[model samples]
Structures are given as C-alpha cells and as structure tokens.
Target: MTRSARRTRRALQAAGAGAAALLALSACSSSDSDSGSTTSGSSASSSSSPKLSGDVTVFAAASLQESFTTLGKEFEKAHPGTKVTFSFGGSDSLAAGITGGAPADVFASASPKTMAIVTDKKDNATVPATFVRNQLEIATLPGNPDKVSSLKDLTRSGLKVVLCDKTVPCGAAAQKALDASKLKLTPVSYEEDVKSALNKVVLKEADAAVVYKTDVKTAGSKVEGVDFPESADAINDYPITLLKDSKNPETAKAFIALVQSAEGQKVLSEAGFLKP
Candidate 1:
C-alpha cells in the first residue's frame, strides 16, 4: 500500500474511534438526565403529599365531645403529620377559652348565641355557619321513677331538681321551654353544663335534670330521658368556626370541612345532633 493511502486509512479509523466514544458519552448523559427527572418527580410527589403540620387545638362544645373525639381520630388517620387536640366544655366556657388566647385553632359552639361572643368580638373567621342543632330534655333516674313525664311535673312539690345555669345553651333552652310551658322549677343546684346537670341526676344528687337530647342519648343507661312537648320551643343551633390565629390554617380548614361534610353530618346525626 502507498504511504498516502496508509495515512488516509489511519485518519479514518481515528475518526471512527472518536465517534464511538462520543456516542457512549451521549448515552451516559441521557441516563443521568432520566435519573434526574425521576428524582424531581419523586420530590414533587412527596412535597405535595399534604404537608400539614403543627398541633391544632380545638375548643368545642361539651355536647360534641364524644363524636368529635371519634372524628378527631379519623382526621389524624386521614391526615399525615397533623395532630388534633380537643378541649371540650360548655359552649360558654369554650368560647371563653378561645377569647382567653387558649391556643385554639377551631371553636365549635353549642349555641350561636354563645358563638356570637367570639364572632361579635373579633369577627374571627370568614363567617360562622350552623353545623348542628340540639334541644333540651328532662333526664331522670332510669324508668323516670319520679314520674316526671312533663315540665309541669318538674314543679311538683317535694321534687328535687338540678338545672344548668341560664348562661349555658342547655340552661337557656330549658328556660325557654319552661317559659313556653309557663312552668316553674326550683332546682336544687344550678349546674355549669348539661353534663353536670345530668351528673347530678345520675349520682342521685337531684331527682331530675334538664339536659340536651344529645346528652341524654349519650348518657346511656345512666339516666332515663323524658321528652316533653314544650322542648320543641327551645331548639338551639350549633356553630363551628376556624380561628384567625390558626397556625395550621390548611389543616384547620380541612378539619372544619370534614366536620361539615356529609360523613361528619351522619356521625353527628347518629349521635343525636340535628343536621343543619
């Protein structure tokens, strides 16, 4: 072979070697790009996976204690990285907690009248809406041994009774019903809440106590519930609101939404809360 032809062949082979090396590097670069894409996609998915954090303290009405507790567990289960702490008490007490800067994220009140204290004070949320309704009932010892069948029966001489103070919703409702019926009751004690009033009857502290229909339903074997026609006159609406100082707004709003959802409505209804 001639020198010129030999040189030309060597140059062509060198060019082919360079081209092969470039193709291999390109393949490696493409593999690295694909890995980067996968990593980015995974990061996005994880970031979008509901990063709800911080503790949410809820000050809710005493009537909602049982059902809200179950719903709280369900909420924590459904929402990762979120913790729900509940403070259940009289609606007035719960409102006081919220007003006292109790680190509460949400407030569920047994009465809009009580909630107005919060709402009227700060206009706390976007707006407060009714979630449920509850009315008062007479709770007596099992079988209603007192023969306390009606509101007028409560005023009978020698009958011992305990009633919630007028500040509470249950107490207010009781008063309205009594007023409607024009019956007078001289309760042995003015209790703080329906639960307290019911406790009085359950522990035999009083012969009869007026409490909520839901409270009686939840009391379960502890006290017998007696319905009166006048009770219909004192139905009260329950309202729930998200606070303005909520640290976990997303979680708080989500929790509120769940409480107002169809599932929550069913749970509340089953617990004797009237659907709003």
Candidate 2:
C-alpha cells in the first residue's frame, strides 16, 4: 500500500478510538449523574418523613378504653418497633397522676374540664384538642329488667342507681343533666369512673347507671342503654394532648394524630362516641 494511504488509515483508526473513548466517558458521567440524583432524592424524602419509635404510655379516660385500645393496635401496626401502654381511669384521677409527676406520654380525657387540669399546669406540650363528644345514657341490666326508661325513673324507690362522682367527667355530666331536668337523684353509690358505674349495673348491684353512651355500647348485652333528652344538655367534650414530660414526644404526637385522623374517628364513632 502507498505510504500516504497507510498514514491516512492509521490516522482514521486513531480518531475512531478517541471518539469511542469520549462516548464511553460521556455514558459513565450520565450514569453517575443519574445515580447521584436518585440518592439525593431518596435522602430528601427520608429527611422530610417523620421518624417515630420507642414506647409510648397513654393515660386515657375510662370511657376511651375500647376505642383507644383499637387505635393503639392500629398505631403499632403502622409503626413497627413501637409499643403502646395505657393507664385507663377517671379523668380526674388521671389528671392528678399527671400533675403528680406521672411518666405518661399522652393524656386523653373524657371532658375538656378534666383536660384543663393538665393544661392549667402547663403539663401539655401542645394545646389539648377535643376529638370527640359523649352523651349520658342510663345503663341498666340486660332487657332493662327494671324497665328503667328515663332519668327520673332512676329516682324510683328501691331502684338502686349508681353514678360517677362529681369530680370525674361522667359524674359532672350526670350532674349537669340532672340539674337541667330540675330533678334531684341520690345514687346508691358514686363510682369513680364511668366504667365503674356501668359495672355496677352489669353486676346487678345497681338497677341503673348514669354513664356515657359509649360505656353502654362497650358493655354490650351485659347492660341495656336508656337514652334521655337531658343527655343533650350535658354532652362531654373529650380532649387529648401530648404531655410536656413525654419521653417519646414524637411517638406521642403521632398517636394523637392517629386519634384525630379519619380512621380514628370511624373507630370512635362505631363505639358510640359523638364527633367533635
């Protein structure tokens, strides 16, 4: 072959190799840019997401036991590695516990008045929000053996009726209801919580109990519920808050969010609690 032709051929081969190297470098740079973009996006997403974990202790009113227990399970299912422990009692007692330095992550009271006990002490990390309302109901033995139909029926002679103490939310509501009706009733016993009052009826120890409608629902066939118009005058507003002393504030806040969420509302409504 001619020397010029051989030179030209070698030059063409060298140019081709350079072009191939440039293309290869461009492909690598593109791949690296894409990988970097993906990593940055993932990091941004992770950073923007809430991080919740650890044990959360919730202090709730007695009337919230069934619904709150269901919500606690849902929260644990949604957040792995998280555990929920509950201390259920009268709102007044729970408030006292919290004020007394109880190590609770959250507080859900049956009434705004009860929640005020905590809020007044600045024990809440956030303002208490009312999530649900409950109305009073007369809980009686199954089939209403005593045929107790109205609030006044509770005052019948020999018809033993139990009521929550005036300090607790349910008791306070009962008092308001009684006052609205201008009827005076002296219960056989003043239970500390709605559940205790309902238990008295369920156990046949009391012929009736002025408890929250939700409690009668929870008691199911064990007790029959009697609705009275006076209940409308004494509806209780339930409030929940994250305690300032919460060890797991993030988790506690998440739980509060869940309780205020649509799913939470559905569960509570099914349990006979009125929407706030």
Candidate 3:
C-alpha cells in the first residue's frame, strides 16, 4: 500500500474509535442522569411523610370518653409503635388545661365557646373543626322510676334534679334547652361535667339529671334516657384541633384525621352522637 493511503486508513480508524468512545461516554451519562433522578424522587417521597413513631396526647370533653377511647385503641392498632393518652373532663376544664401549658397534642371540645378559650389564646396549631354534635337528654333512674317524661317534669317541687355547672358544655346546653322552653329549673346540685351529673342519677343521688344524649347512651341500663324537643334547640357542636405546643405533631395530625374519618364517625354514631 502507498504511504499516504496507509496513513489515511490509520487516521480513519482512530476517528472511528474516538466516536465509539464518545458514544459510550454519552450512554453512561444518560444512564447516570436517569438513576440520579430516580434516587432524588425516592428521597423526596420518603421525606414528605416520615414513619410515624411516638405518643399522641389528647384532651377531650367528658362526653367523648367512650367513643374516643375506642378511636384511641384503633389508632394504636393501626400504628404499631404509637400510643394515645387522653385526659377527659369538662370542655372548659380541658381548655383551661391546654391554655395553662399542659402537655397535650390535641384538644376536642364539646362546644365552640369552650374551644375558643384555647383558640383565643393561640394555643391551637390548626383551625378547630367540628367533628360531632350532642343534644341534652334527661337521665333518670333505670326504668325511669320518676316517670320523668319531659323537661317540665323535672320541675316538680319534691323531685330532686341534678344539672351540670353553667361553665361546662353539658350545663350550658341544658340551660339553653330550659330557656328555649321558657322553663326554670333549680337543680339540687350543679356538677362540673356530664359524667358527674349522670352519676347522680345512676347512683340514685338525684331523681334525674340533664346530660348529653351520648352520655345517657353510655350509661345504658344504669339510667333511662328521656328525649325532649327542647333539646333539639340546644344541640352543641363538638370541635377538635391540634395544639400549638404539640411534641408529636405528625401523630397528632393522624389522630385528628382518624376522628374526622368515616370510620370514626361510625363509631361515634353507634355511641349515639350526632354528626357535625
């Protein structure tokens, strides 16, 4: 072969080899870019919702004891490593505790007015949402021994009736119902919470007590529930929110979601609570 031709062929081979190397490099770069994007997307997905672990503390109204207990159990079962602890009492009392720097992740109140005590103090992390409602009912001794059929029946001079304190949701609702009927009631005693007032009837301490319908249902055979029309006018909306000082906000948020979920509503309904 001529020298010029040999040189031309050698240069052509060198150029071909360089092109192959460039193609190989380009392929590797493309593959690396795709792998990097996939890794980045996975990292984002995992970070957006970290695995929930830790405890959620809830302060709820007295009327929510049973239903909330059931929900707490469900939450624990759903999240293996998580737990829920509740402080149940009068709405006013719970709100006061939250505002007083009690360590709680969530707050569920029986009335908007009571919830305002926390919200007004800017103690809530989120806007309160009404999850349920309750109406007043007359709880009497089993079989309604007193035959307390209506709201007016409790006014009998000799019959002793118990009422929740006006500062509490149950008491406020009872008063509203009484006011709606243009009736006056002077209870033998005023209790701090619905459970306290209902206990009066269950223990036969009083002839009857005005409490929430849900509480009456919880009392079951312990007391008889008397439905009154005036109660409809005094239904109380139940609100729930995450606390601003929550130590486990993610878990608290999950619990709040569960409470507002369809399953949670089912449990509350079965317990005789009204939907929001």
Candidate lDDT scores, in order, read: 0.87, 0.92, 0.94
Superposed Cα deviation of residue 190, candidate 2 (Å): 0.3
In candidate 1, the residue pairs with backbone N, CA or C atoms under 3 Å apart (3 or more residues apart, or in different chains) clash, namely: none
Candidate 2 residues 66-152, lDDT tens each?
A: 999999999999999999999999999999999999999999999898899999999999988999999999988899888888888
**Candidates by TM-score, descending order:** 2, 3, 1
Winner by TM-score = 2
TM-score of every model versus the real structure? 0.81, 0.86, 0.83
Lowest lDDT block of 10, candidate 2: 44-53
The RMSD (Cα, Å) of candidate 3 is 6.1
Residue 231 in candidate 1 has what lDDT? Answer: 84
Off by over 4 Å in 2: 1-40, 47-50
Each candidate: how many clashes? Answer: 0, 0, 0
**Candidate 1: where is the Cα deviation over 4 Å?**
1-49
- Tens digits of per-residue lDDT, candidate 3, 1-276, equal 999999999999999999999999999999999999999999989888667879999999999999999999999998889999999999999999889989999999999999999999999889999999988899999888778899999999899999999999899989988988889999999999999999998899899999988988898899999999999899999999999999999999999999999999999999999989
* Highest-lDDT candidate: 3
Q: Where is model 3 more than 4 Å wrong at Cα?
A: 1-49
lDDT by residue for model 1 (103-182), tens: 87898888989999898789376588899998788999988887888889999888999889899988898999988887
Q: Candidate 3 lDDT (Cα, whole model)? A: 0.94
